[model samples]
Target: MKEERRRHKRLDLDVKIELEKLDEGGVTTVKYIKADVSDLSRSGMGFKSNYKLDVGTFYDTQIQIWTKEVIDAVIEIVRCEEKENNIYQYGACFVGMTETDTLKIDIYQLFNEE
Candidate 1:
């Protein structure tokens, strides 16, 4: 079995999130896509999307948690795998998430564990 290497625990999630590709300078491009979130953590997230995202690319998006609060974050694609029927699964790390937002996720996770 592959050893777990993640720094934070991931919360299983199922939600749709909008993503806008960011240029090298951190500016948003005209390209936009929607992805289905599979899991979330303070450091990163896993998602699947029909739109293919290049590894090492950055994207801006807002995630709405179970409490209905939205957190804006910029994520960098670290891994991508081509799934069946042209769907892509991606692993992304948060590049521009504030500490407060990260704390919120942690708090939610703590509550969920009980």
Candidate 2:
């Protein structure tokens, strides 16, 4: 079995999120794309998108949790793999997510455990 290197446990989730690429200077660019979140955790998330994004790049987005509260975060793409039919899977780490927002994700995970 593959060793799990993740710091936090991931929760399966299906949600659509819009992302705006950040420039080298950390400024948001006009380029926006939509991605489907496959799983989520306090530190990172996995998502799939038709639009290709570069690894090691940053993107800004707002994630709405199950409670209908939105968390604004910046994510750094750690890995990207192209699948068939132009789909790409991406792994990203939260760059500047606040502790309160992280706690919210944790709380949700606690209540929604399988």
Model 2: worst 10 consecutive residues (lDDT sum): 23-32
* Candidate 2 lDDT tens digits, 45-97: 99999998999899999988889889889999998999999999999999988
lDDT of 1 by residue, 38-93 (tens): 99999999999999888999999999999988889999999999999999999999
Distance from true location, Cα of 4 in model 2, Å: 1.0
TM-score of each: 0.96, 0.95
Whole-model lDDT values for every prediction: 0.92, 0.92
Off by over 4 Å in 2: none
* Cα misplacement distance, residue 74 of candidate 1 (Å): 0.4
